[model samples]
Target: MQSAQCSGRTLRFGFFEVDLRASELRKHGIRIKVQEQPFHILTLLLERSGDIVTREELRQKLWPAHTFVDFDRSLNKAMTKLRAALADSPESPRYIETLHRRGYRFLAPITPIREDPAESHANFNHAALERAAASLENDQSQDHPKTGFLLSHPRPPATWTWFSLLLGTSTVLVCLTALFLLRVNHSIALGSSFGNLNPRRSVAVLGFRNLSGDSQEAWLSTALSDWLTTELSAGEQLRTIPSESVARMKIELSLPNVDSLGAASLSRIRKNLGTDLVVVGSYAILGEQSHGQIRLDLQLQDTQSGETVDAISETGTESRLFDLVSRAGEHLRDKLGIRAVTREEAAALAVALPSNTEAARLYSEGLAKLRVFDALAAHDLLLKSVAKESNYALSHAALATAWGQLGYDENAKAEAKKAFDLSANLSRAERLLVEGRYRETAREWGKAIEIYRALSEFFPD
Candidate 1:
């Protein structure tokens, strides 16, 4: 239990306070209602927030030890009423959350106030005696002070009584005052943290521009963009937009000169895609050899701040495209503190298809064309890629997405299922894509669109 003061009240977390002298529940400064028998049950639970307060224990506290009551029903009713009054639910609760077969736990943190330690001690000593007097008063023994003292202690003189009462009242007030100050401090801290949060701490990867003069290199660009999107989305913490949506947005707001799409364009892209950061990159092949060197120029810019946060270029052999993507992803992870899927784990989960194989290469090229909104061309190339290598899962998945986009639901569903079966670690977004195609086949356009939006977040470039 923590102690603090807020608004001149002593608000207590555990153990309900019953200031019988003032007829209030003053844990700190705020007054909690304690109407009737509910107060007895509340007090017991408060004293032991995380511990079980058995029905028998509550009955003993509320009624006499010898008294017999229908413990189960009455106790349950009281707890339900208490929870209702406190605005707490057994399911998805905040304050008095339930613990199933066990008992309840007071989840709220408690703060108590300590004002004038010396005075508090002195008042405590006197308050005990005053309470005794009050108990006697309730028992119709107020007049016979000496008679009450035979069982306990006698009341003092009138002047002494008034002085003790005043001291007790002052102590309660002090507790309340301390509680108020503490609450205000806590509120301020929460408000400050919330206010200072930067919404521009998010980024999206746009589909990479294919600068390979040869049409065969197109797959490499799509493969790089798709892999990067997957790596970024794996971070989970970073708010990455989906590649599919970015691809659509890129075509919708086609800026001819890629370099001309600066801060203003980035802002428009972010607004259109509902993202904070935008990433744009281009890839190029520099030789005619099968294992040519590929260069990637990548940039990350904050939409709201209109400033670049990261800009770097990586060059690697085209044969090691996946490896380059992995390295690039690691770089971004280090720069932006983005979490990444481990190489060993990612490799183990990856669909085991020959990357450098002709079929895989063709599929990768088709995917690239699809990224740039050339769906028909992409479809044709992807079909060729699959024909050469029917076992390539990625090509099959890409083909499925293309088919779905072009309204070939039956074919898309079959391909997506094959992808799901072949790929060990299909992302949530990818799974949604498969489901979306399945839903589309059933003519559920609304649900299919919803799934597509979700898939876009993971694939958004």
Candidate 2:
């Protein structure tokens, strides 16, 4: 029904005027074959014409109800398709502009036109069917003898045949209704499950309390916390809180050290962390060998109900910290019936990044400093981290964070964009911070921190 007039013969934009309804791309009057999802993405860009579309917004629009899709892969593929179709290189994009950490924006103009005659006829038929029942209502109100006779009855049918027909029709309708209801119920159940699924799993890993009487392993608690944060972060499913925040909370609560905390302090720590899951345990160094044991106590408590859905503990040795943490992660996944990333997949992700043990250690140190609001120190450490491993996505993300904290918006954005371009696994919070959206940035950071905390408990050294 909607139409517009075009004064010119051609609707041109760098040799392309995509047909939105048909989901077709035409370059200089030559058709370009674009896949379904990419075509939808192009259509979305065309509709937005002159505004920035955030990646989050695009994800929600394109994959509104599906969570299984690899959004990063699909989105990048679509963008590649678009660039190829438009002959626009990423280095010097003309039609579509990539806004780095933000979303995409259409750099061209789009003009609407009236539907052609054949298209108009097709639309009319579709509209006519949609209005058919309303038209019949008006027709029924009119004085028409044929309509009245037809409505009255069908006569002279065989009684047995009529009965059989009626029975068969009723049975079919009942079956259809039952099937529809069953599907509706299934959808409702799945909807409930989806509602319970939080992409950001929050947990607080309390620093290990040093129970050993000797002061020789004084730094053990801090080292354990840092190690756990790093090892646990290896799994993308968890959002571990930075150790600095936990340390700050401990100081604020006037708790001398993690080991000095009692049951009350543990509860207070959980509240301060504001996490769904709380991890509490103690560690002791045995003899000169520095042998230590850790027990990971996990509790998923409801904020409203104050009840725990999951509560379990796992014991492990310092030598097998990674294995212990992986086991705890499995337990948590089992408790929630959540899907997990396989070890091979996790290793692949780790290898794909530009980070080694030293770079990771520096990055972790920088993150801890950043958590305590030490922007200068964090920046210095993060710079060293990236210098050590230039392609490290997490380090780039951390550098972006430090830059943003120091008011270097452009530099921060550029670094963040590079990080995401290299690997989408950079903590979500780091990505948001680079985008200049503080609230969302904090939210994502919190989520990442919580996941780290949970992992730390399971993998304590």
Candidate 3:
């Protein structure tokens, strides 16, 4: 039957209709296959609608009071299945809002179709219309002050005014709806050419190739990658895989050491790291270390297509290496088609980056050493990095890792706390990492796990 034929018993929300008497759920007049248990749970949530449906209530309704089962697990599994069928996400729920351990509430606004065709036809904003009509009648009585005159006169000016007001309101609503649809269509046309799009794009910055031919400055390879990754993480639409995670994965996969990655390598990185884009780059530092020129080249590779989607390049003085990194990061972000940060955010980001090239170089090398399990070298390098720029938040965070690796619990906790304190200007991902590290040091496993889970949701690599 057509959705229009659904009686007053039928509940409608969005494109879905629930016919309780028929024990059926239909979306756009097509029946959806929902299991018995999940359907019952859905029904309960729907009946309660705006109110919370507690777990205890659900359990009592689903099973007898005397019955025994793994209630929590069963409820969770049912919810998962129901959400899968609805194509809903627990994190950003559309229809069902989870109340953690308490209960669930249906989020969508529901309308019950009237049994009479005339009433059903007028159901659109019926409540508003009723209120308007009642208010109009009261005003008409107050103005005329003659019930007998109103009864005799079958027509009142207030009646015409109410109709005019309703008509104007409906016209405005129609125009707004049309404009909204036009904007939606325009957005869809401009969204993508390939038609394969994700709400958030995940990217990984592989260790840059050091073409400087300077063994002492080899740290630039990992340093540049980490710096770029951190910079990209500042974007709301981009999820960046941590440089340490990418390095560890590279070692685990036994990937070849090369300047550029092949298709197979890109595919493997995508599969293991869950990254949509891989940034591969090379840098060169010419002339002398103090008065040298640095040229950085970067490529944004689409993992699925194994193609270099875009290339970025920047040149600057070697002494202002961190400035070059920042410029390169901005270039790469533009190439990715991500929105630029606001003025305030840009200022905060500037503060988050290392103030001096020396501190950045030391921190990068320290982070690289720490990833390789050389806690002693990492500790020395990171200590000197902080000594050079004590307010560098990332340096303090890396130092905490070094201390933790060396089994200095007190020192690790102190460093983690310091990092957290300094993370106000850091990127969202960096701030979360600092908070998680601090929680771990404080032995707050639950809070640490929650923070890590949130980070995983944001980055997912």
Score every model by TM-score. Answer: 0.48, 0.39, 0.54
Among the numbered candidates, top lDDT falls to 3
RMSD of each: 23.8, 19.6, 18.4
- State the C-alpha lDDT per candidate: 0.64, 0.61, 0.77
lDDT of 2 by residue, 172-210 (tens): 999999999999999898677455444566665666665
Comparing 1 and 3 by lDDT, which wins? 3
Q: Which residue segments of model 3 deviate by more than 4 Å?
A: 1-199, 453-461
The regions of model 2 sitting more than 4 angstroms off are 1-202, 210-263, 266-273, 282-324, 331-355, 407-411, 425-461
Best by TM-score: 3
Clashing pairs in 3: none
For residue 237, give model 1's deviation from the true position in Å.
2.7
Of 1 and 3, the candidate ranking higher by TM-score = 3
Judge candidate 1 at residue 77 and give its lDDT.
Answer: 55
In model 1, state the lDDT of residue 101: 39
Give the alpha carbon lDDT tens digit for every residue of 1-461 in model 1.
22113322444454444443354663334565556676656555655655666655677677786677776445555665565345344434555655433455667655544444578888998999999877768665654556654354576899999999999999999999999999999879866746444343556677567776566565665567667777666635566666667766764565432422577887788788888777677888877663678888887777777888788788887666667777787788788865667665476425443455576677766765566534556678888887887766667778886665444567877877676565545555556665665566556799888888776544443
**Cα lDDT of model 3 by residue, 1-461, tens digit:** 23333345778888788877877887877887888898899888877777889988999999887788888657766776676556554445688887756888889887886565567667756988999989878877876667523334455599898999999999999999999999999778756532544558888888777786778878788767876776776756687787777876775565533456779889999998989998887888866753678788888898998998888888887566657777877877788787776677667668777878788888878877766555667788999999999998888888997776554678989999999999987877778989998999899999999999997666543
Residue 285 alpha-carbon offset, candidate 1, angstroms? 2.7
